[model samples]
Target: MDPDRPLIPAELNRYARPDVLIEKGRLRFLELNISTRLGGDAVARWLADAYIGLCPESGLRRPPSTVAARCEALNRMRHAGNGHGGTGRLLIPIHSVIDVSGARQRRDRIQPVIVAGAQRLGFEVFQADLADLSLDAAGRLLVSDVPLDVVLLRWYGSDRIIDDGGGLAALCAADRAGTVGLFPRPESALVSSKAVLSWLREDCDAGVLGPADRALVRDHIPWTVCLGLDGDPEVERNLLRMAAAERDQLVAKPAVGQSSNEVIFGNQMSAQYWQSAVADAARESPLVLQRRVESGRITMPFRDRESGQRVTTRVPFVLSLFMVDRAAAGVLARHMTPDLPDGDVVIGMRHGARPNAVLLAPAS
Candidate 1:
């Protein structure tokens, strides 16, 4: 049943909340979604507007539209003047064929936020992508050839596309040794799955992603069978131990998947699905089953379309909350469409309404 206003905004909306910071000043809005990023130079022109607005010295040779052109424009603008950073600025790009597509636009959810945010914070703004990002037509390698200061790993909930950031973290050691700042942390990545509950078993956690979800991880053995042999016996024991110490019958997630790729009831997953190939199966790739996730019942509180009463039932749309560096960034309640299964509601993250970073609640 569809509600007039999505629960995303209703339960916990950053914009509607009271904690966001607002300096009395002028503000502008720009989007950088999948389609817009593919729009070639037009997107670049949009970025130029931001750069020029920030720094006037950035002389305009011509409005650029391509990646290289936009990079050039931004360079001229930021570096030409005194430049904002003590360290020289850098630019990087990631090419991906599996970027956001269809009715959902990437920009609508977020913009060139990293660059813009960093530039504002006095750090030299830079961009980079894997050598080959199937998402962009320029499918060529972005920063494979260049040395990088940061390995910006992308972590969306799923991995439907080639460049959806499935194996990005493993590469962090090889490429960037200094700082591998993921968009969200490892905590955010694993929380979506039953693994979260297991993780907290030794640590002590709370929420909907509670002990049940924990039991699915380590310290729990009778619950799991040895399917495809776990490499290290210790690793296996640790996993089972973690599971036993935690909760059970929870949603197992692809370590790196998005929206609703392999979203299934925990009972459906096989042992093979749990190991090395979790991302593959979760993303509908060629990989076989990993490990099983615990599954029982899922009931959510939803408002009936006709009756004003809030009913507890199950529907595809699940409540999701996002954070920027651990700060409550935004919230969205999405309808389950085919691809996304959980298509998002109005997606927005206002600065003022965000929660305090100091006050954090573990995944529930």
Candidate 2:
């Protein structure tokens, strides 16, 4: 389903990489990243050898790299609307001053890995902040004096991208002149909305999906609804009824948001607090309430270098799939404390948690 409007206004639409949840042998579609920028390639590169060595007996294999596909996607976008293509000089833009929120603070941690991976895949890669990006007199996008053929934008979200007016203007100018490419065409942001899950559920309920599709939807898609946005009395009444009735079974999320910011799991709060949260969510951004599903745990090996010992622990984790050029590229496993079943590994990384590259093997 198309969003009412694009998250960031633009001319083209492409792919959206979504975050999904699996519980009790079922898949649950979660929110999406319009930018679709996961530092997976970098992480996989960092962990590839170590993981393979550690799991040699398990027949662990390297997950496919996304560098080539991403480069090609940008190249395709560069030539799609305008007949312009060349040896891709890709520039990845990151925030110079890290946000106070402490999410994706510096590309320094991930940029070098991406650079190495991209270089291996045969692309000229550069990293810069908005301050260093500009449009030259001839309308070419330049990063620190070097003209960029494609930009692998990691500005975080579409909202953040829109707020970078000067940089966005320069980028847009370059795009208009067919001098540069954007990995994700801005219109693709439309697919990132959690609202789409509701539409999918509606279609499922309406019997629009055939048996195979209906089974997939029923097994994977949670019951999600956009509440209090329209201010219709009947809609609001029904929302409150369902929300109150299933307080412990619900999870509330911002309709258009990222980084798991301000997500409220109903089971964790009091009835009074949940009501207030639902009210406040409606007042700010339209909110979606989905049935919460508990995630299972996985056994992971952790080695203590100082002690020169290895131990295995069962940790709660969420598996994320990375896609490039519309194909499965790799898998990422984020471990979290068992207490916080829905905890975000990215957020946990700030405090200290390591992300793992998942090697998928057939069932024995």
Candidate 3:
């Protein structure tokens, strides 16, 4: 993709799944995952259902299902494009060779739920390894002899698409030739990168954004800067100095990572270790350093395994909000308990955080 060319405004409207932490009674966005590969929706639906079943008098409604919303979004995109009319086939291309950390295992567990949801939505859904895709005479993507109308990318690392050779070529050709609709177009991953936050901050500083956009950045986005020295040297030097001096107020994250993998809290690291980590991360890949917002704690009920009784405990939690086609879909909340060994400043399922159902209160 051309760095100079701006993304089409329509493509930017696909999805915005932002992970947020509540600090001082305000929601602060930690990072944005703009692709269709957002997981935990199935689990969230299950939890919401179970909660409603156990407490029918709560007077709260279950949050909308992300899977159902995603299926509907895909169907709309297909119809808007050149999709085959009745019961078009949707193929979820899995990457067998490249796995992003524990993505393959999570995808394996989540795929069945997604497929079941898609099937219920009236689409003949199928999953296949990327290597299994083929192109017909019209550049249409096919799995075995069946042509596809839509492709859902379940894989995490978009950069690895180039490594798949023919599968990548055929898929790209099909998408570009309008033979098949690709949800959350591949370029959507670029908008998801943590580096984009840095760019937004830069744009705001340069007065490139309008008043409303600038206010949105100032109100929601934390102070963020890319770790590497790819841009202005003086700005890079100032960032380096600030990182070294304000270690307690910052966090370092990989620009294109998920599940809080390799996220380092500056307060948790010694000055020497923090410097070394920043240097190492800068050398490896694009990294972002952002001002840390301490996550607020909430009291929730949980069963005590050893005592065989229910108890309430305070835990740090993050709320993930999903917006499809610029409309609010639902929210999924995950909290980390103090007793968990893997509990840290970062909250994610991979780090032992447990999903909590978020229900909407009845209107007054």
Candidate 4:
């Protein structure tokens, strides 16, 4: 590690996945996934397994595939005990509240796939919402009466987990007693906020980084300023003024947000709307005004669900790079239209920009 680099919280070391974009021979990092509740671990493993099974030859080139690597990491954690007995029983904590019907569907389809993988690796797996779990007076965490060894968090965010007094208190008690293990170690959420990224951006300009580190931050992170919180009020005020004047060159993002919620793009809206959004964003919640990077548009073929034929369409794509313990793990390529920045995957499965499995070609 470079001494000049910004000090990443010790908690983020457990899992440091960064969302990055590779364009024009430059790698731009958007944000870090420090929270353990992050999704897509299951998806990444599933995709890798499916791809390797479909084309065994590719596996020969990319040795010790992503899934294999992840399993090794999990097994290591299980064996470490980390104050708990290495019983090899892992619990995946989900959101306590959800539409019962949708939750059932996820239990039936989404979770079983990941459970199967865990079981194959010599581990007992249990899935339950956080509410279903209990920490007894003895500080033993249990799910349906079974003692848990480690927690593979699947909940989306930490705010809910931390706010659930019973759950939060139990987890903290167990953590202090060293009775159970949490993959992300809980403190990772502190750095997960976009506000931390803004601070990092400031560090770049302050010459806190070495020459090479400075170049990386300058080339990757967008110029960002945290608003509605700590920082030079004058600087933030100037940034807001500039955003209003040059509406097409900037975007305002929530400092603590997820899944593209309340992301206001200046280029796509009217001046009045953009200005209004900036004001509301700054006032409602801490926000970061980021210089917008135009996405790269490319054409790719997909098998149309209805037509049952391959169709080629042009869309803006983002390369989502996954990292585990600071090591590269997987890459997911997602594409969307200019109008829909984050893609429309949730509204309609086939309608939104979707990710495709990476296929490797034979070496020349």
Candidate 5:
């Protein structure tokens, strides 16, 4: 560990990290069945087993092959609208973070959210990191190569992600111009960004709170600081004012940052000292100073632990809403430790969620 890096604790240690928590029960496990190290298919197997386990609901485990067969059936849905020359495929490239630097490098440590989600959704989702996405070419992601449907613009941390507007906008353009039907960016960008969240609240400001919104924001979001992980100067100055005026309990985050990494607040921050760091963070993109919430998430289509049946249940809580475009897609109710500033990223993988537990936008 570098001496100059922010002081890290055992949990924060990138080397060891929060236990991978692979297999908790006879059925619950994370590591792909080593017996089949087949390409992307290994990941596909996990989803199949997960879903098959859901189908039984009698606490019976599933054979790995059963899950793979179910997952392969997802190809058509992945290309629904675009299959008939609608749009080639939504191209959600991830090249912006290649050379950018600021937040702690935890990309390797971060779990593969997109890959897993794709697996569960049963799509053979293609992946391209910063370098693969960087090459400027028309065929960067050729339409003929694979069956593509929606483009999932993904990233690990908030530091570099919020500022990737160019990349996202490009994706948006590709979806509209090409053969893709959707381009939903990462949850961190669509929900966590203060700027975007503020906009959504204002738009959905129908003069009253939905029953779910009221339940979620009970007691003004029970959070202390606004963690701004952006680097734009303008965004930084605004953060200083928010800390000075509106939001006193605030944190300074790099524009390109990871959650809880570089988060400085309370006694650690000086109204003046943070302004410089806030200014540094602002250069990248607009950072936000927001009231925190005890957030948690439960992915839909979860399987029951005891029965191995498809039933939704709550897992790790990371407060982030799920969406496709501006319309509300699905709101996650994640459970976090009561006393921590952070939460787990991938908490559960179960069958579709219950109707009322979440707020989902209408089908697109």
Candidate 6:
């Protein structure tokens, strides 16, 4: 993908799944993960199976299957606007370089789960590194001489594509010529920035959002401001003032980041450190200062790994809603046990959080 190329109009409208935290009985969106390289689909399936086995008589509805929903999403994308009606070959390109953070190892573990699920649905699938993909003379994406209809991106970061000598150019050429489709679209890289969320809140504050849009923003989106040398002067001034008086209620996040890496919680910092950190981040690149939403706590049972004894404890949890083709597909819940040393400020796999099933209760 060319960094200077303007995105097509259709690319601007694509949506991604939202990672949400429940606070005060409302869903507060932490980030819009606009890429298809999302985690937890396989974990969701495993958790659902374990949950159903443990609560056979509970009468709660089984959670929708993320694997099935994602496979269906791929089928739809393969056929959408391409005029190819039959089953199409899908490829999951692995990155050539693996970072020390273990992201590649995690993706490698889950790729087979998705491939198996897609195979059961009668679609042909292939997995290979980005270097394995090449464009044929006709500009079609191919691996081992087999043409591919869609590329399911499971790798992290678009910068990897740019780092490849010719892979980025080939993919862009194939995508532009309509010989292949890229799920989630490359424009997702642009939309996934945390700055976009700040922009949404800023637009609402500026009265640019319509009545319904304003209500939606007010209800779900947290108060966020992009902090940088080029940022809105009024917004930056107000954010700094609030940070001074109520640092405990704020968090600073990189405008483009994954996991909890480099996330700074205001409450955990001294007043001097907080001020210096904010100033340093603004000088380097645009970062977002958002009102932090604390995760809701729930009591759930867990079996002790060493003793095999079931124990119940309170834990902090976050709910992630998966949206496929603009429709709600399923929900995934991740929680951290009370014993973790990180306390409740951050919760993720890196922080010892575990995936839990979300079972829907029967309506009265």
Write candidate 2's Cα lDDT for 87-206 as tens digits: 667777765443536543444445455677567656787766666678878888888787777777664343333234377678777877767766666556656778878878878999
What is candidate 2's CA lDDT for residue 196? 75
Q: How many steric clashes between backbone atoms does each model show?
A: 68, 0, 0, 1, 48, 0
Each prediction's TM-score versus the true structure: 0.33, 0.77, 0.87, 0.77, 0.38, 0.86
Q: List candidate 1 segments past 4 Å from native.
A: 1-92, 97-110, 128-151, 155-193, 202-257, 265-317, 336-364
**Residue clash pairs of candidate 2:** none
Tens digit of per-residue lDDT, candidate 4, span 1-364: 1123344465466565566655566676767655332334455456656877877866423222444445556778888886557888887765443432234223222345456667889889876666667776667787788878877754434333322436655655666666777765545555667887788888998999899988878888877778888667788778778888988878787887666667777878899988888878788879988777765557766677777787777676666655666676656666664344453122212547555555445667
Instruction: Highest TM-score: give the candidate number.
Output: 3
Instruction: Give one digit per residue, the lDDT tens place, for model 5 in 190-257.
Output: 23333433433433455367767754433233322223443345754564666665334454443233
lDDT of 6 by residue, 1-364 (tens): 5455678765543446688988878989988876453434666767777877888887776566556677877777766745344448888776544454534332344456678877876779888666667888888887888888888765436333323546656777887777887766766667678888888997999999999999999999999878883866887778777787788888998888777667898989899899888878777887888888887788888888878889998788887787656667678788997567645466777878887778887777
- The parts of candidate 2 lying over 4 Å away from their true place are 1-17, 35-38, 41-45, 55-58, 75-82, 94-110, 120-122, 126-138, 142-147, 156-165, 207-212, 300-313, 338-354, 362-364
lDDT of 1 by residue, 1-364 (tens): 1123233322121111111111122111111111122113233344445655665654532222233332333343344432123133443334444344433223122246545544554545445444332221222122434322222233333333244363243333322332222221222232333332233433433344566545543333212222123235565556444433332243333333333344333333454443324333433532112233221223445566676677665333222333332233332232322222232121122211111111123344
Task: Point out where model 6 deviates above 4 Å.
Answer: 2-15, 35-39, 81-87, 98-110, 156-165, 232-238, 302-311, 341-344
Instruction: Report how far residue 66 has shifted in candidate 5, in Å.
Output: 18
Tell me the lDDT of model 1 at 189: 32
lDDT for predicted candidate 5 compared with the true structure: 0.37
User: Which 10 successive residues of model 6 have the least lDDT summed?
Assistant: 100-109
Error of model 6, residue 167, in angstroms: 3.5
Candidate 5 lowest-lDDT run of ten: 29-38
The C-alpha lDDT values of all candidates are 0.32, 0.66, 0.77, 0.64, 0.37, 0.74
Q: How many clashing residue pairs, candidate 6?
A: 0
